[model samples]
Target: MTETQRKVGFLICLITIVLAVLDLQIVSAATVPIVRDLDPDHGVDKIPWLVSAFALASAAMLPLYGKLCDTLGAKRVFTGAIATFLLGSALCGAAQSMEQLIAARAVQGLGGGGLMSVTMVVIAHLKGPDEEGTGKGGSAGGLVAGAGMAVGPWIGGLLADHASWRWIFYVNLPIGLAVLAASAFVLKLPDHPVRRPLDYLGAALGAAFSSALLLVTDWGGNRYAWSSPVVVGLIVTAAAALALFLWRQTRAAEPILPLSLFRVRELRLGFVIQAIVGAAMMCAIYYVLVYLQIARGVASSSAGLYLLPMAIGMSTAGLLSGRLTARGWSARTFTLSGTATTALAFGLLALTTGPATSLWLIRAALLLMGLGLGQLMGQLILLVQFAAPRHQLGVATTGIRFFQTLGGALGASVFGSVLARLYAADGPGGDVSALARLTGTAHAEGVRAFVSATDVVFWSGAALMTLATVLAVRLPRPGRPEDTEQPARQPEPVPA
Candidate 1:
C-alpha cells in the first residue's frame, strides 16, 4: 500500500475507535435522562445495567473477536462489526422499555468489541512489522481515544438536555455510515488467504465464565442477597467455567486465549496494572458525574463540562508519555509514577469532595487523576507489545484490552451496588432523582446523603488505585538487557 492509502486507513481506524470509546462516556452522561424518560418508576435501580450490559457483552466477545480478525480478515470482520453496531444503535434509539434498551446495548457492545481490537490490528498491518511504526501508530490511537472520551459526556449531556436522550444513540447513524463508505472505497488492508480453525469450545467457555462472573457482580447484592441461591450458583458457575477454559487452552491447537501469554513477566504484570487502571478509571469517570448531578445539583450538560480538565490532563500526558517512551524513557518509570499520581489524586478526592466543596477544586483533582491515567494508558500497551513475540502480538494486545474491559465491567457493577446501598440507607426510600428534586429541608438532606455516599465510592476508587500502584512497582523495567534481547534471526512475516 502507498503512503496515502496508509494514512486514509489509519484515519478510518482512528475515527472508528473514537466512536467506540465515545459511545460509553456519552451514554453514561445521558443515563439519567434516559432512565427518567423510559422507566421513571424504577429507573434508578436499573441504571447500572445501562452501562454494565454493554461492558459485559463487550468483554465476553473480545477474545473471540481477536481470533475472528485473524481467520476472516480484518476488512471483512471490521465491516460486519460496524454494521452490527449501527443496527444496535438504531434499536437503542427506538426502544421504549428498559429491558429492550439493555438488550440492544448488548448488541451494540457485541459490535463495539470488534471496533477497538480490529482497528489496532489494521493499524499494525498498515505500519508493517517495525518498532517505530508500532510506537507512532499506538501513540496516535491513544490520543484519539482519550480525546473522544473527553468530549463524549459533554455531547451526550447537550443532546439529552436540549434535544432528546434518544439522540445520543441516533447520532451514530451518519458517522457510522460515513465510516462504512470510506472503509469500502478508500481504506486498503492486506488480506490473509489461509484460514485457521477457530476454537469454538474455548470461546464458549470463556464467554460463559465472563457472563457468570458479571452476573455475580451485577446481581449479587442488588437483585439477590450475596448468599442467595442465584448469586451462589452464578459464582460457582463462573469458577467452573474458568477452570474449563484454562484446561481447554492446554490442549486446543489454537486456544481463544493463549494461556502461555501469561508466562511473560512484563505482559503478565502489565495486564494486572491495566485491569486495575480500567477499574479505577471507570469508577472515577462515572461516579464523578453522579456526584456532580445528584450531590451538587449540577445540570447534566455542565457536569460534562467539569470533565474537561481531566480530559485535557489525560490527552496532554498521554501524548507526552508516548513521545517520551519512543525517546528511550523507561516504561517502568511512567508506570510507577503514573499509578502513584493517580492514587494521590483519588486520595485528594476522597478527603476533599463534599456538598459544600468548590467545583473548581474537584476539577483540579480530576486533572491530576487524568494526567496519571494518560501516562499508563499508552505506556502499558507499548510494554506489552514489545514483550510479546511477533506471532502473538495480536493476541497479546487483545488480551490487555480484554482484562481492562473485564475490570471496567466489574468496577461499574460493584460501585453501583455500593452507591445504591449507601444511598438507600441515608435517604427516603425512592429514586435518587426524586430525592434530589425535593424542596427546602428535604433537598438539603438528599444532597448530604448523596455527598456522603459519593465519598465512600471515591474512597473505594482510591483504594483500588493504591493497589494498582503497588502492582506497578513490581513491573520489570522496560528495555533492560534481558527484555531487549531477541533471537538474532527474524521470523518470516505472517500474512495479514
Candidate 2:
C-alpha cells in the first residue's frame, strides 16, 4: 500500500475500531439505571450479567470471527460485524424487559467480537513488512484505539443522561453506516488464501468454557454463594470444557486460536502485560462510574463530565508522545517511564479515601496516570509486531485481544463482587441489602468509610498497571529508537 492509500484504509478501519471500543463503556453509566428500572426487585449481583453477558458473547465469538476474517475477506467480515452491531442496537433500544435487553446485548456482542478481533489484523496488513512495518503508523493505530476507549464512558454518560439510555445503542446506527460506506470506497486490503475445515469442535468447546467461567464469576457473590452448587458446577464445567478445548487445539489441523503464538517471547509477554494493564484501564471505568452515581450521588451525565478530564489528559499526552517519538526519542525511554508513572499514579489514588483530598490533587493524579498509560498503550503493540513473524500477525494480534478480555472479565467478577460486599447499604445512600451488613453507629460510619473506599478499588487497579511496568522493564532493549518509534523510520531504515 502506498502512503496515500494506506492512510485512507487505516483511517476507515480506525472508525470501526472506535465504535467497538465505545460499546464497551458506553453502557457503564447507563447500567445502574437500566438494571434498576428493568429489574427493580432483583439483587445487585444479577446486574453484572448485563455487562458479562455482552462480554461473554464477545469472548465466545472473537476467535470465530477472526478465523472467518482469514477465510472470507476482511471487508466482508468487517461489514458484517458493523451490521450486526446496528441490528443488535436496535433490538436493545426496543427491549421491553430485562430478558429482551440481555438477549439484544448478546446479539450486539457477536458483531462487537468481530470488530474487536479483526482491527489488529487489518492494521498489520496496512503496515506490511514490505512497506513501513513499524513506526508512526504502527503507534498511531493503537493510540487512536486507546483514545476511543477513553471517550466511551464520557460519551455513554452524556447520551444516557441528556437523552435516553437507548441512545447509547442508537448512536451507533449512523456511525456504522458511515464507516461501511467509507471503507468500501477507500480501503485497499489485499486478499489471502482461505483456510478450510475450521476446528468446529474446538470453537464449540472454547465458547462453552468461556461462557461458563464468565457466568460463574459474575454471579457467584450476588445471586448465589461462591461455595454453592451452581457456582461449583459452572466452575467444573468451564474447567473441563477449557481443558478439552486446549487438548483438541493441539491436534487440530486448523485451530481458531493457534496455541503456538505463545512461542514468541515479546508477543506472549506483550499479551500478558496488555491483559493486566487493560483490566485496570477497563475496571476503573466501571467502578468510577459507580462511585459517581451511587456513592457520590452524581447524575449519570455528570459522572461523564467529570471523567472527561482524564480523556483530555490522555489524548494530549498521547499526541505529544507520538510527536516526541517522531523526533527520535527511543520507544524504550517512553515505555519504561510511562509504566513507572502509571504505578506512581495508582499509589496516589490509593491514598485518596478521605473527603479532604484536594480536587486539584485528584485531577493531577488522573493527568499523570493518563500520560503514563498513553505511552505504554500506544507503544507495546508495535513492539509485539516487530517481534513476531509476518505470517503469524493475525493470530498474534488475536492473542493480545484474548488476554485483554480475560483480564477485563476477571476484573469485573472480582472487583464487582468485592465492591458489593463492602458497601451493603442500609440508608438511602446505597442498595438496601448492602446496609443490612452493618450494625448501629458503626454501621453509619462503616458505610461512610467504605464509600470512601473507592480509592482502595482504584489502588487495586493501579497495582495491575504496576505489574505492566515490571514486564516492560524486562523487554530486550529496543534495536533502535527509530525502528519502532517514528514514521520516518518506516519510510527510511535506521542504524543499529
Candidate 3:
C-alpha cells in the first residue's frame, strides 16, 4: 500500500468509528419525539427496545464478524458491513411505525458490530512493513470516539428539535455512502488464500449466551423481579449456552474466539483491565448525568454538556500518550499509571460529591477520569495486538471490545440496583422514580438519599479500578523474547 492509500483508509476508518459510536448515543435525545410520532398511545412503553434491539444484535454478531475478517479478509468484510449498515439506515428513515424502526435498528446493528473492531484491524494492517505497533492510529480513533460520545446526544437534540427525529437515521446515509465508495477504492487489504471453515455451532452458541445474558441484565429488577421466572429462565439459558460454547471451542476446527489467546499474560491482563475500565466508565459518565438531573436540578440536555470536559481531557491525554509512545513509553507503564489515576478520580468523586457539591469540582473529577481512561482505551488494544499470535489478530482485537461492552452492560445493571436499594432504605418511597414527583421536604430527603447511594457507586468504581491497577502491576516487562513480532503476510489482490 502506498502512503496515499494508507491516509485515505485511515480517514475512512475514523469516519466509520464516529458513525458507530454516534448512532449508539444519538437516539437518547430523540426518544420522546419518536414515541409521539410513531405510536402516541403505546410507543412510550416500547421505547427501550429501540436501544436493546441494536445492542443485542450487535453483541450477538461480534465473534462471527471477527472470524469472517480472518477467513475472508478485512477489505471484503469491512465494505460488506458498511453496505449492510446503510441499508438498515435507509429502512429506518423510511419506517412508518415503532416496530419497523426497531427491526431496522437490529439490521443496522448486524453491520455495526464490525464497524469499530474491524476498522481497528484494518488500521493495524495499514502500518508500513517496518513500522511498529499501531503508532498514532489507536490514539486518533480513541479521541474521535470520545468526542462522538460527548456530542451525539447534542446532535440528536438539535435534529429532533429543529427538524425531525428521522434525520438522525437519515444522516448516516450520505456519509456512509462516501465511506463505502472511498473504502472500495482505497483499502488494499490482503485476502486469505486459504479458506478456513468457521465454527458455526460455536458462533451460534456464543451468540445465544450473549443475547440471553444481555436480556437478563437489561430486564432483571427493572422489567421483572430478580426472582421472576423470566429472568431466572434466561439466566439458566445463558449459563447452558456458555457451557456448550466453551465445550465446542476446544474441538472446533476454527473457533470464533480462540481460548489459547488467554495464555498470553498481556492479552489476559489487557482484557480484564479493559472490562473493568469499561464498567468504571459507566459510573463516571452515566451516574454523573443521573446526579446532575435528579439532585442538581439540571435539565437532561444541559447535563449531557457536562461530558464535554471529560472529552477534552480524553483528547489531551490521548495526544500526550501517542507522543510518549513514540518516545519509548511501554504499554505496561501506561496501564499502571492510567489505572491508578482513574482510581484516584473515582475516589475523589466518592469522597466529595453531594447534593450541594459544586459543578466545577465534579467537572474536575470527570476530567481526571477521562485522562486516565484515555491512556487505557487505545493502549490495551495495541497491547493485545502485539501479544497475540499472527493468525488470531482479528479475534484478539474484537475480544477486547467484546469484554468491555459486556462489562459496561453488567455494571449498569448492578449499579442501578445498588442505587435503588439504598434509596428505598433511606428515602420516602421504595421507587427512586417517585423523586421526580416529590416536592419540599420529601424531595430534599430523596436527594440526600440519592447522593449517598451514588457515593457508594463511585466507591465501588474506585475499588474496581484499584483491582485493575494491581493486575497491571503483574504485566511482563517490555521487550521480552516471548513477544515475537509476526511477519506481514502477502496479499491476494482486491478486485476493482
TM-score of each: 0.87, 0.85, 0.96
Candidate 2: deviation at residue 200, Å?
A: 2.0
TM-score of 3: 0.96
Residue-level lDDT tens digits of model 3 in 63-120: 9888998899989989988898888889988999999999999999888888888888
Count backbone clashes in candidate 2: 6
Give the alpha-carbon lDDT of every model. Answer: 0.80, 0.70, 0.86
> Between prediction 1 and prediction 2, which has the larger TM-score?
1
lDDT for model 2, on a 0 to 1 scale? 0.70
Off by over 4 Å in 3: 482-496
Candidate 3 colliding pairs:
none
- The best-first sequence of candidates by TM-score reads 3, 1, 2
Model 3: weakest 10-residue lDDT segment is 484-493
Candidate 1 lDDT over residue span 380-407, tens digit each: 7777776776556667777888888778
Comparing 1 and 3 by TM-score, which wins? 3
Write down the worst ten-residue block by lDDT for model 1.
483-492
- State in Å the error of residue 442, model 3: 1.1
Query: Could you give candidate 2's per-residue lDDT for residues 256-313 as a string of tens digits?
Result: 7777656555666788887886677766556655655544556766665655556666
